[model samples]
Target: MDPWVSLDPPMPAGARARAGEPGGARELVTGALADGTKRGDVGGHLELAAALGAVVPRPASGSTATLWESLATLGAHDLQLARAVEPHLDALAILDEAGVAVAAGPGATWGVFAAEGPGVRLVARPDGERWLLEGTKPWCSLASHLSHALVTAWVDDRTRGLFALDLRDPAVRTGEHAERWVPRGLPDVVSTPIEVEGAAVTPVGAPGWYLERDGFAWGGIGVAAVWYGGAVGLARRLAQPVGRELDQVAHLHLGAVDQHLTASRAVLAEAAAVVDSGGVTGSAAAALATRVRSVVVASAEGVLAACEHALGPGPQVGDASYAAALADLRLYLRQHHAERDLAALGRQAEHEGPWWTTRSAT
Candidate 1:
């Protein structure tokens, strides 16, 4: 039997081949995980990413569907692996956007440490012809393992800049407060604090360019794609056949899961098209991301609830994959920002005319 149903629409035979069809991401990840490679092994995950380099298309490269599908495939197999690889891909995309040449050396893994927290600040200052970063950065996932990172730091009180730095630099310290990241979901993917003192860095783009670029929105939607995939992985448990036939109640839950996943997949596909077409720019891209993320988050949450209702505690305890997927997805979906993002979308939608109007109605 197939691992999971394909959430994407049909594509041309040649396009499918280019999009990592046949034994692509699914085979690579499945084979790796089966070979005693732990999900939390950051080094092993980086090797997987390197192996998948040929297949995983970069976002907005006219094969956005392919890129997302590959990510979904990873998430389906293991969310921790997906979590480890997604930021590396995003960092490469960001560097490409800023016209920086990516010298991806052997085993060179990258991450984006852009999250800011209260009372913790990383500052960047001019150092002759180069830039140096000081202070601390929070939410640096897999920091100890990653060789490079794109860090966002305050250049001034009102300005923040994005800089690429070598994590191996002696001035950079990771795993501060290491004991604080005790979570059930994604326990292997530890996100800790890092401290850097006068670490030499390379500026990727102008101040504020990271958030202003259209890729920022595109990256956000990419994360939603992973969430959708993780939910799909969880929902697959419902499809497994036991010795006896499933009753009507089980069937009902499966149907609902299908509905939610299908909707989420549709929006992601639509957003990918918009991004590749370059039809939306500036704030429009942000709006598109907000809308896509909102739809995916709701669908993922609904699927999560339905899976728990349908499968009950048997799979939760009996199936390691199912249980880990459940926890990882629940934690991963929290990245959506919940009500705050919805409120922002609401503010944007208020000025638009009607929400329910169809093209035929117009």
Candidate 2:
């Protein structure tokens, strides 16, 4: 089978071999989880993190480019599972930036609970030698098995702090409303509201450091990589000769999807190179992330539409893997926030001037 062209540099040998397998998408995730028993975390599966070079620092074995490629590979496999795993790796990126040490061993997985939306209010109070978290945290992913979590909570009316909490503690309660996660799209990911009362925590960084850091926007772009991967997954099916007998209209749709995916990959690759070079910082980081995310999101939306129009509903209903990939990508892409985020970008662009005027020779 011919692989879809998404990244600039071709997929690595190991990743390529895995992507080429029969039922490879499901198999990799299952194998990753199974490998967890070797270390100590019987139910944990973080092999994807290590594979994506997310567990190790860029200077060590991973780079921004490698991380994005690995995320795209994972997205090609199973996106609901990919969605489940992305937060953990994103948490690692945050912790690394904050000088927080997290072991990438089997059972020592981490999660991020910084979704500071309404309905949950987690407060960190100073306790003797440590800190305790009080209140509920909404949208806590992998709350059941995560050994630790990088949580964001309101420190004051105007300040927020990031804390590292040990979920192994008895005071923390997860799955408070597991029933509410009824979306079939990412059902198994299990992102439910959590209740933490007097749960001890370690301060990760100074107040406001978490959001102010460059990694925050970098992480957003990292998520865009995953979204691109999902788009690739959808496009791969269209690339095949098996879909709908391959007509001229289908060929046109495939060409559009291929162009969209290629453009997205190139944009992401450039963004990664810029971040790795430390070119993204302060307001510049936000601008770059917004720009890359917008392009990738648009590309994904276009690919998804072209795929559906070309392939029809037969594949969606008959092919389990294809169906799941479509559903997962659709739901995961919602992270883009559509016009809201675009509007925010527009507001920023109004102050920053046009892209062509600011272009510099790299």
Candidate 1 — which residues are off by over 4 angstroms? 2-7, 10-37, 102-104, 241-244, 353-362
Most accurate candidate by TM-score: 1
TM per model? 0.91, 0.85
lDDT of 1 by residue, 30-56 (tens): 566566557677788877776766556
lDDT of 2 by residue, 1-362 (tens): 32222356556665643233222433444455444322222143344543433332331122566566656766665675556567777777777677877454654667888886666599887878888889988888778867778999878878889998888779998867777777756656778778888987888889899889888888888789889988987887887847347779989999999789888988897887788788557988888888899999999999989989888888888887777777788888887878988888888887774465665555
- Whole-model Cα lDDT of every candidate shown, in order: 0.83, 0.73
Q: In candidate 2, which residue ranges exceed 4 Å CA deviation?
A: 1-6, 9-62, 102-106, 241-244, 358-362
Over the full model, what C-alpha lDDT does candidate 2 score relative to the true structure? 0.73
Evaluate candidate 2 by giving its C-alpha RMSD to the native, one decimal: 5.8
Task: Evaluate model 1: give its TM-score.
Answer: 0.91
